[model samples]
Target: MILPIVAYGNPILRKVGHDIDENYPNLDKLIEDMWETMYASNGVGLAAPQVGRDIRLFVMDSAQIFSNMDEKDKEEENYPDAPGIKQVFINAHIIEEHGDDWAYNEGCLSIPKIREDIYRAEEVTLEYLDQNFKKHTRTFNGVTARIILHEYDHIDGKLFIDYLSPLKRKLLKRKLDDISKGNIKVDYKMSFSK
Candidate 1:
């Protein structure tokens, strides 16, 4: 099943997600659906909040980013974590963030047609559980880290647009409003607040 992504201005996106346990209803099914929804929406990551579920869960496949890159570009951009990872995260927490911040043009499925250069740390150490409730603590770098951080924010009630400057956000107010009111076109399914 391809879940409908919650659009910007949805109150669920602004609420901090709660942690879930193994016994959570239909955990496997939900995770599977998330993967299907993410692929259908052509997104690298999707958080539970994005699908209108306030739970500390997200699915990411940074590997897709590298696989889509041209051979020449891949050679030039020798990211250590290139060819990244495809995994599910549950009850995730960032233990630490390392390295200087780098700017990347980031976009969200919920806030379609809006991309912005967001600055984030180059590396991150995270502690999270897998689909089976098995715990793992891992460190990620480069694009992989960025992807994790982006989805992590969603679980914490934060959005990439929140990192923008006040003036920049003001300039995009109209466009943002349009998204909230379903005045935009997106290939995948989305649920608007209004």
Candidate 2:
């Protein structure tokens, strides 16, 4: 099912998600629904908070991003070889972040239609579990790391907009307010706090 993504200003988005174990109700079904919702919404990543669930879970299919990029664009963007990475992350924690921070244009499903250049570390080492509750500690870099970092923030009760400077955030106040009140036009279904 395609769940209605929670919009900005929703209190759930501000809450740090709790870790869930394998026995969590309908874990497989929820992950399936999340994938459907994310692909339907044309999002590279989706966190549980975005769908109104305060759980440490997220899905990413950055392969879609690579499919849309041509060779020149890929070369220019210095995008690494992202070969159709489709994975689920549960109870994730970033163990460490390496390399210098780089600016990347980031966006979120909760904060629809708002994209900003956010700075993040070039690489991240994460410890997380897969759908089956199998644990793995992995390191990611380049565009993949950027996407993971963005979604990781969601589970931590942080938004990309929060990284903006005071002046930049102030300038986007009206637009953010509009999003909270369902004043923006998004192709996907969204639930607002109003």
Candidate 3:
């Protein structure tokens, strides 16, 4: 099933998600639907908050980014974590962030048509549970790290737009408002706040 993505201005997006355990209802089904929804929406990552669920869960597939890139581009932009990872993250927490900050144009399914350059650490070490409630600690770098960071923010009541400067945010006010009120066109299903 393809769930409607919660739009910007939704209160659920601002609420910190609670951790879920293995016994959470229909955990397997929700994970499956999230993957379907993400692919349908052309998104590399989707958090529970995006689907109106306040839970510390998200799915990411940075491998898609690499597969879509040509060999030349891949060679020039060498990301050691290339051909990235596809996995589910439950009760995720960032243990540490390393390396200098780099800027990347980031966007969210919740805030469609809005992409901004956000500066984030080049690498991140995370502790998270997998689909089967198996615990794992992993470090990610480059685009993969960025993707994880973005989705991780959603669970913590943060948005990529929150990283923007005051002036930049002010400039995007109208577009942001439009998105909240369902005034824009998006190919995938979205539930607007207004």
Model 2 C-alpha lDDT per residue in residues 60-127, reported as the tens digit of each score: 98788889888888777656546658889999999999999999899899998889999999899999
Candidate that beats the other on lDDT, 2 or 3, i.e. the better one: 3
Query: Which ranges of candidate 3 are over 4 A from the true structure?
Result: none
lDDT accuracy of residue 43 in candidate 3:
100
Give me the runs in candidate 2 sitting further than 4 Å from their true place: none
**Alpha-carbon deviation at 101 in model 1, angstroms:** 0.2
- lDDT at position 16, candidate 3: 98
Candidate 1's displacement at residue 59, Å, is 0.2
Clashing pairs in 2: none
Query: Which scores greater on TM-score, model 2 or model 3?
Result: 3
C-alpha displacement of 41 in model 2, angstroms? 0.6
- Judged by whole-model lDDT over C-alpha atoms, candidate 1 comes out at 0.96
TM-scores of the candidates are: 0.99, 0.97, 0.99
Single out the weakest 10-residue window by summed lDDT for candidate 2.
75-84
Cα lDDT tens digits, model 1, 97-151, are 9999999999999999999999999999999999888999999999999999999
lDDT of each: 0.96, 0.92, 0.96
How well is each residue in 1-194 modelled by candidate 3, as lDDT tens digits?
99999999999999999999988999899999999999999999999999989999999999999999998998888788987999999999999999999999999999999998999999999999999889999999999999999999999999999999999999999999999999999999999976
